[model samples]
Target: MSALLPLPRLPLTALAVAALLGAAAGVWPGAGIASAQGTAPTTQPSRLPTAPAQSRGTAEQASVDGVVEAVRQTVLAAQVPGAVVALQVKAGDRVKAGQLLLRLDARAAEQTAAAGAAQVRAARAAQDAATREFERQKQLFDKAYISQAALDRAEAQYKTAQAEAAAQLASAGAARTQSDFYLVRAPYDGVIAEVGVVLGDMAMPGKPLVTVYDPTALRVSAAVPQTLAAKLPADAKVQAELAGAAARITPVRTQLLPTVDPATHSQTLRLDLPPGTTAVPGQFARAWLPVAGSGDARVLVPAQAVVRRAELTAVYVAGADGKPLLRQVRLGRTEGAQVEVLSGLTAGEQVVLDPQAAARIR
Candidate 1:
């Protein structure tokens, strides 16, 4: 009651103005009133896109390629040098074994063979006369009409005549064989790949007259490095592709040439091809020789799952943490669509199909 004596009274408008100013100050920056009445901020979880389902299969280490080769090939040449009289077969002609391919001027050989035959006949006549004389002498000796020395001399003459006749017969047979050589015959059933002699061409010994090859017995030959030669097995399986046809072949033999080429450092490998296939010689081919003792249980995947980068090969493998990782892998042989994983992955592990996209993302 004592403090009320100094009090000053204010108008109603001034009191109302003071109240509005206080409210404005409360809504300005640094004031905590607006936050108390506002809603809380919210967050949403991120979602990654899912990959599509793809089909996959297991793979094994295998080698595959095609080779071109002739089944059998040989050069036909004249055994005796002479002028070519008749050419029966031409290039690209199919011929049977023992079919006449060419003929030489056989008049000379025929004359020689005829002379030898006449000599044999004359020798036989002389042998018959000597035998008759020996028989007559033997009868005389048995009756004591001729001396033992005389009978012995006749027997010696008869033996000499017989030996002469046998020699003549052998000479005649040789002459006949030489005459037959004038007619060149095919050594085997084959196609004439080349003709080196014309009708009037002079054929000489060791000179190629014709080249023949068998299409059915064709084989593929390849030069393998020395390092790889040791690993090749005698029974290893092989396949060849030629002229749009694929052939399955077996390793029948492996011939390591005694000499290795200084430049290539490789040896030749000859493979026996199956019958009824058409492979030609002088055609290039790619071959795979399986390394011996290199086969074992391995983790394999489809070949399509692997991608080649610069100087490296990579595969996409799904990790247990639900993320795919790009892995560099060493590869081995390829069997069909499957490939061997030499390193980087394990068995029963999941690998990404269409690894290109996965690799790109990584």
Candidate 2:
């Protein structure tokens, strides 16, 4: 079964970005883009052919698939091996921090801890005896009843016992801590998304027992092409269309992870959703990101000027002899009435705005 909640009417930005991901994007299929700057092919307005849009605008918008994720989540894991004796919470249960979520049979751990305690007591008794002996030896040395060598031996024995006692105390404390790990507790206030172990199940150290997430702290994670990510403005405006939400929502903050994926050539973009927004971890979302940069400027043409055929994207260009010649061109993003041309037809070239009209003239 699909784990994701079904998304609503697909966002337009998602489709646009997904379609124009590669180097040679054929999104427009011979669509007209703005003509190059400083060059205009003089053509009559009523003529069958016209120049591409005269102005090259720079602002661009892109969209990509985003997934809702919790900003804070934890998968509780067992720190000591034991049999699962009790499970206090199941999936979807809300819990507070430090709340007991599961209990493990700690009979073996209890024995180990008791053994550690006995060792500590034994060490302390030995240390006390050593102390008394050293005191007695010091007094004998002072009164000349014992030799200096005998006093020094007693002092060394006392110090050795003191060290042993300290070591045993630390060992006992560690044993007690390990025993406490047999009782699993929630790390934070969150909903239990998963319960990995059942009563009577044997849990090994490092095995996950429960998954919890804070439902209120959510963000949208999307992967954007490196080219688009590099061009994103410092204060770029971001908007999101969350699954099941009535309208688009703005992110409270935007962040871009520095590392880029080697395989996909994309970087992860995270947008923190505002508080009180209805969203769940793993839900689908679409984010519109603004792409801004400067270059030689884009060539845009009217969408109606595009001529598409099987694997063919071209336009009828006015030849030197005033005849129509089909010219192939690569395309880019669409802006309202016009699309960007990545290559092929350039400035000073007369492109037929209406392919049908040019066909009749030919």
Candidate 3:
């Protein structure tokens, strides 16, 4: 019985394959462990301190955020369609009035003008010959050497030549005027804000090629709600706090736009920065407008409670479930540490007192 016993065996290739697979499995877990040790976990947002919102009736003054802008900003467009051949100026370059900013391909325009000039010269030559012929005919008729009919025919020919010469002269003028369109020029003294077209680019009529702005005359334009806009008198004196450390709170001339925006229900207020003020275009500005009436309840929160990201502004609102949720909000103006909340929150609701504490949520 002992001599008939036998052992089961696997093929040599199968055993080698199994050994390689087990080695690979072991290497994979070690690689995963190394990776897990090198990577760090994401940080969680910290819990922010909360406070109940309070209502503030109409105050003595209202402030609104505004952007400092150039009094005259223009996006220059091409008057003629052609391939751009040269660019004379770039972004942020200072330009003078009538200065050339760009040039387009002028071969076609030059050819047209040359042709017109040639026609004008030929027409003038024909007119001069006609005049000479008429004068000779008149002299012959005066001497009784030619008939009246011949002189009259010569006069008719002279008038026709004069008309033709006039037409050709007008054509030449028009062609020259059109040729001027191949050159783009600045309208006023300003700095080039942007260059939209490059050399060899096809520029079409009405296509924007560059933007220019007069940096000397800057203004701050803000959108004020219609409710507050109507209350402020037309002659109310406003003051703006220009941005930066060396900035001064100076009195600015305010012009209320007559129309109200239908969608936002706000009116645009243009505040002219006083002459000699050291402020640049596109800077942040805030204007303090005198408030008229009282008894209108509005919510005011600390400026630290609001979060700003580029064009988006938001705040942390505490829900009934004791969770703080970030919500988008529209902000009006700032009064020192306090800011006006235009929308997205109601009075008596709890909000995060410090937005920085929850910055990780963003």
Q: Model 3: how far is 292 from its true place, Å?
A: 3.6
For model 1, state the Cα shift of residue 278 in Å.
1.7
RMSD of each: 12.8, 24.9, 17.8
Candidate 2 lDDT over residue span 1-362, tens digit each: 87998879866685466556532564442243333444676653345656654446564666788999999989889987889999999999999989999999988888999999999999999999999999999999999999999999999999999999999999999999988989999888889999998899999978988999998899999998888887888898988888777778889999999999999999999999988888889999988887655345678888888899999988888777776678888987666778777788676567777788777664
Candidate 1 Cα outliers beyond 4 Å, as residue runs: 1-67, 227-236, 246-259, 290-362
| Model 1 backbone overlap count | 5
lDDT of 3 by residue, 40-77 (tens): 86655556688777788766677788888899999988
Best by TM-score: 3
For model 2, the run of ten residues with the poorest summed lDDT: 29-38
**TM of each candidate vs. truth:** 0.60, 0.61, 0.65
Q: Is candidate 1 or candidate 3 better by lDDT?
A: 3
Q: Which residue pairs in candidate 1 have backbone atoms (N, alpha carbon, C) closer than 3 angstroms, thus clashing?
A: 66-240, 66-241, 70-218, 71-217, 71-218
Candidate 2, superposed: residue stretches over 4 Å from native: 1-60, 292-362
Candidate 1, 142-176: lDDT as tens digits: 99999999999999999999999999999999999
Task: Tell me the TM-score of model 2.
Answer: 0.61
Rank all candidate structures by their TM-score, best first, as comma-separated numbers.
Answer: 3, 2, 1
lDDT of 1 at 246: 55
